[model samples]
Target: MSNDAVTPGETRFYQGEGQTQPLFRIEPGINCQFAREQASELMGYAQDLVLDGLLERKHNMIWAAHYLNALAKALLDDAELGLAKAKAL
Candidate 1:
């Protein structure tokens, strides 16, 4: 339930009660172009996997479909924000 955004190039290490230690690192940059490309790639991969029988066409399809949809939505959102920023600039 933490609403804090992770800064680029920052590393976060977590240790908690009854849990093993884990570390996470955030990448640098807000490269929207790369994000869009990645989102496209992920969507294609999900589609291929589903068609190739690697992914189930049932409940698992729903999960993969959700991720693909989410990625596309995120890419669109980022593009809109980038456009807005460019206009402001």
Candidate 2:
């Protein structure tokens, strides 16, 4: 799909032939921006959790670390996508 032609809130899905399963649409625009921002903020919280020795408390550390790593990867992917979009423009 052309980048500029993409609607800000349109939902697109992929499906295999003969499959009746529903497809999930990627969040667009402000919603996506908010989600990414929240992820980033959560990552910071995870760091704090680890730094404050909260890791030993009810396995919060493990959960925090996992989320931090996942968010980092996602953020990197988003950055790359953004860079590509900019270049495409």
Candidate 3:
């Protein structure tokens, strides 16, 4: 399946002259309920990176939102699958 409809556009937080830092594209390829757990792991990595000075604060927050969104989508997909199974029965 194509990720087009599901993929969210990349974004950057904070602006102006000093905000030119590159942002990371952390789009999750989530399709199953189990895969939804990735958000927590990604958040952990983001926190570590920020603490170690590898990532910016604003950038971390942006990616954090992306991870959470992915988790939500996983839940929605799971619910849809359940509905389909129920219809079959």
Candidate 4:
């Protein structure tokens, strides 16, 4: 990992050993760090399922990812509101 944090508008590309194409796009946001972490974890889980050859269980993974995304969004919303509260205090 690089020491520099990813700024908004910048995209990070991943290249796997056997991948001829880009593996994924990573966009970092300072304000939504927690949300980004959660989303990444959820995506990792989904990828594991696919790699394990459990294609039939893909729907479950999708649902899990959806819920995790919602949770992350909620967390980001709270963090944004918390900043206001902190400033007021």
Once model 2 is optimally superposed onto the true structure by TM-score, how far is the C-alpha of residue 11 displaced, in angstroms? Answer: 16
Q: Which scores better on lDDT, 2 or 3?
A: 2
Between candidates 2 and 4, name the one with more favorable TM-score.
2
Q: What would the per-residue lDDT of candidate 2 be over residues 49-77, giving only the tens digit for each residue?
A: 77665635657676667656565445544
- Which tens-of-lDDT digit does each residue in 1-89 have in candidate 4? 22222224233333446776643333434444454566567666655655554566556766655544554444445444434444555
Looking at model 2, residue 69 earns an lDDT score of 52
Clashing pairs in 4: none
Q: What shift in Å separates residue 1 of candidate 1 from its native position after superposition?
A: 36
Off by over 4 Å in 4: 1-57
Candidate 3: where is the Cα deviation over 4 Å?
1-57
Model 1 scores a C-alpha lDDT of 0.51
User: Which candidate has the top score in TM-score?
Assistant: 1
Candidate 1 C-alpha lDDT tens digits along 6-27: 1233333343466555443224
- lDDT of each model, Cα atoms only? 0.51, 0.52, 0.44, 0.47
The predicted structure with the larger TM-score, 1 or 4, is 1
Measured against the true structure, the TM-scores of the candidates, in listed sequence, are 0.49, 0.44, 0.37, 0.39
- C-alpha RMSD by candidate, in order: 9.3, 7.8, 9.9, 10.9
Worst 10 residues of 4 by lDDT: 1-10
